[model samples]
Target: MSLNESCGVYGIYVEDGEALPYLYWGLLAQNHRGHQSHGFAALSDGIRLYRELGMIPALSGEELKTLMESLPGRLGIGNVRYTTSGSVDRESLRRNAMPVLERGSRRSIALSFNGNIVNMGELRSSLGLPEGLSDAHALNRLLLRALEEESSIQEAVKLCMDQVEGAYSTVCLIDDGTLLAFRDPLGIKPLCHGCGEGIKAFSSESVGLDINGLDYCGEVSPGELLWIEEGSLHRERVRHSGRRAFCAFEFAYFARPDSLFNDRYVYEARVQFGMNLAERFDDIASRCDIVISLPETANDAAYGFHIASGLPWEMATRRHRYVTQRAFISKAEERELILSRKVNILGRKIRGKRLAVIDDSIVRGDTTRSVVRRLRAAGAREIHLFITYPQIIGPCFYGIDMATYGELIGAWRTPEEIAEEIGADSVNYQPIDDYVKATGLSRDELCLGCVTRRYPTPMADEMAREMWERLRSSEREGGRIYEG
Candidate 1:
């Protein structure tokens, strides 16, 4: 399916010196987060920016050097956008590209955003914009309009939040020296701050900070605004909407293992998830001979699964770590073939074994089907598929683009049917209660809307109907259905 959420973002404010190289490295470290586009803006005497809708490594040696050298500022912001809300069509693609630059009353603002905004339609209608306005454009317009009346950039951001709703963790460069950063009231997306030398940086993942040798300050709290100028940072809690709901997917499937979320390590969380899964399936532990993980997102949970079950674990599938671009699988048939090619089965490890495969989640049955087929082909006596997350029975209305109910395999098929389709001896998913508990956060602090469809933000009936119609048309057009 066409994956919707983008990965990570990085921004820096360095003393009057070249910051593009640092921004480039930051983006490089975050390259896994987004491969579709890369861009950076620097402000020295004026705003100098460079961006292209392609992978970072795709830039020719000379092209890379030219963009790096041309960037003119000590203060800069960079974004790597993965299309989540819009289509990949040419017009939609261009509209979703980020570090959206705009000229404001006080100065120029180059905004780089990471998360999806759910209320774009309502916001557009309220702003009196055209019906066809994309979320990126609508957001840019809202930010600009807020700036028109507010005193400072931070105030403008707070005022803008009142108009739009949904998950957003954003960074904006205002004028040549000032930087503004904010996370949504729910803080469903991650945004963190770090300091290095005379440089201060903000990123969606802490790995960006570690790559740049920056000291982690802490995460930017929800409903807060940060302003950075001349290597110094100031913070103001503009809106005190204490309600916070961090996206659980960030820990389960999105953030880098080494990254930290809300002061908790992602790798640790996965280990905890595995521990919880082990306890839930304690009786099945002795029936499995070995535990194997579907790398690399499932590696941590697999590790946890192994430790909890006391099962001897081996790497049955080898992954080519360098493949960074999104694997485009157009059809279900093609998806199965591509998945098989992506992982190589170690016959010696799987032969004559009763294996347990630990995976992050089953968005669709294609990838899991391929993996199970390869394992059984290698003489695996039996295979049990364990998903770290519960069945995703509904679409995510917040930001994640999970397919509609009709397309979700879990929505129509039972566990037995899923097991049969995937050719597994049995299929088990983490219970929703256990999954929520594993995060060590309250229910209200997490968004389980993808699994339950009880969206935090109200989804109007008309919008839901429109989305359903779109899904139906997409099915007719033979587009990849985004089941979770």
Candidate 2:
């Protein structure tokens, strides 16, 4: 299913006149995380922030040269973002694009951040910020307030961590040209740092590191604060908790397949998901004539399914390379167009065949329903869906696009009901136990918040409960409850 990706946060600390290259490539590599707007804040003399709407388009030689000339700095933070909160209008897009720079009386901060803030309403009121502001804005204001009052950056970060709740993996630029990066107390988002020669960088995903040829350093620990000053870096275990809740959806959908999380590439974990599905449904696997996968994310898993079931994996569906609009964040009209028009089914492989189709997840039921209809038209006798991720039964508040119970088809429907609605003969999902094993993380280590309805952060859990009540009574129609 289509789901909006988390924003990508990138930062660089390097020699004078050297930050642009890393910033440019880092955001470019992970542009899939966000395509609506992109920008960077560089501290050349003071912080210089520039942002533009739409995806980072292809550039010729002259365009690249001109962009580089405009942004000059030794260290900086950058972000490519899509709205999970706040306004969605054009003017708001420009106003809210990161890196968000804020200044107080004695201290200032420019930050590029990922993850959602669950206490946004209270945070906005406490900061006395205007309504409908983005989570990043509210967070930047809160952080700026802390930086102004606290003597040390670490202390300020700790205070900020204590105040804000939910997922946040951030990279910030300080006034003195120092760079700091940190993760939320529960680590609901991914961030990692690595150094190469004279350059040190942090990114929301490892694909950014791979693009810059940086060494593969591990994930930033939960609640750890890391800073780079004068090219020398120091680390502090700012906050510690017995539970860690990294977003499990990252392996299932949001993160790039090449990204390394918990030492295993996301693609590898997805492949294991396929193997696990095959094992669980060996009876169904035996009846399938061929296995096919939805193009893109589920390709590796389909390959694994083929290996496990010993069935030929047919390339039955082909995606339109030019259709790049993601279904989750697109307007309803645009989403249907993209989902239906973006892929075509090969009649030869599908006609008169019993098929086991592998896909990532079933969210709103639109994308899958459309695909099933296409396959039916192609003469498939029976369709069985093998989904990589477990069924998402609850709304996701930690930056995933799904934040409303009404929008989630799996929220109240049983597997049989979902299959009937989506035109699948059977719908099979990997057991949550095996899904956890594939990530190389224990069940308690990952944020199964959406699937299990147990949130790591207190505020998100409380707000989710309130929203659930509203949703049940049909009192709330749309939008995130935390956004209230």
Candidate 3:
């Protein structure tokens, strides 16, 4: 059984005007989050949903018009997804595509969600849901169950919040034209609300709202529910765990740089991450001749390193403009080919230079190794890696694809060992404290489970402990424990 996936979700409720256009642009802006599939759900007389494998296509004028005509509604939600959950085959990808719609005897509902459910097995047993259901399906079923038992949407959501475990940022569209959005008590994923003329919207990232000309309202607070009906938006604090465990990976890699959290742009935080790296690795900085990033995500950090270290930041590697999919999110079998075609190295510029190469993170070392080989072939005399995120030492019970100890290159190796394994002179990961400081968020407020091996949720923490013990022994670490 495949687990869950990290995805991007967008929902809009407009008092006037159609919601499809705004939802389209909103999801499009967040295409970087997931590339495997794109989908949309609109609420007209009833919910109309269209989902397909692959990114949202660049529609021609006529095609856009046809899409608009097909899904006419004043409220809608959209999703872009990549699988860490379910099967990755074409058939499964089509089956798992969202926004996921569930029909019941009394009412039907549509949902678009990000993050995983840690206690899915228990939930399934308790709710009597069958196996082979995607996390989104399980969640929707759980909500439907709650809705059947409760008197109001708020009460149902509160009950679900009390029962469900793990990271989830969700948006729901009820058949009665009600639009609802909520985050888990821990706020382990990103979800925010925005407003515009006669419109209220919810997106997994602030950049989504930015693209749609919406005013930045605020985050849908941890455990808070926001619903819109009869042209009015209502807020309710369903449950608060008295703490926040926002995913730190968002700032390190997943989110678009322009995304905002706590009034600070992710780009600015990444730049600060570079400065922190420079300060921490001054010795390495002194020895390096030039700095170059591993294309787009690391570009900001590379610039920050140059700014602080007085080194020249070289644009020695250029990403293919048309190759927009992220290698980190791609399947392992396809990653090497994608990276080879996605980035081009300017060999002449770095033919003899000792380069400080910046990157977001080194997951399995395939991407880093491939890039290092290309750099060596391009005549880079020396390569030193500066990683923005700390070393990932365990599986992520949330939504990240780093699922097993054996899959993570840094899980059993030190920085020096990893450097040797990846063909680099050195590997410098941003320190935990420095990373938190750079993000402008407190240490207790961020989730560092993948790096620290200390999860915020109870089940995840226990699962990691058991997985670690299995990995240490000769026992075969089976599939994702969450699925187990």
- lDDT per residue for candidate 3 within 78-151, as digits (tens), equals 99998874578887788778898888877788999999988888887887766666788888888887787788
Quality of model 2 by C-alpha lDDT? 0.85
- Sorted by lDDT, highest first, which candidate order results? 3, 2, 1
The per-model lDDT (C-alpha) reads 0.75, 0.85, 0.89
lDDT of 2 at 67: 73
Model 1 residue 66 CA deviation (Å) reads: 3.5
Candidate 2 clashes between residue pairs 3 or more apart in a chain or in different chains: none
lDDT assessment of candidate 1:
0.75
Q: Judge candidate 1 at residue 44 and give its lDDT.
A: 69
Model 2: lDDT of residue 323: 79
State which candidate has the highest lDDT. 3
Clash number by candidate, in order: 2, 0, 1
- Model 1, 303: alpha-carbon shift in Å? 1.5
Residue-wise lDDT of candidate 2 within 149-238, one digit each (tens)? 878888989998998888899999988878999999889999999888888899999999999999877889999999999989899989
Off by over 4 Å in 1: 1-5, 58-65, 104-106, 126-133, 326-334, 460-484
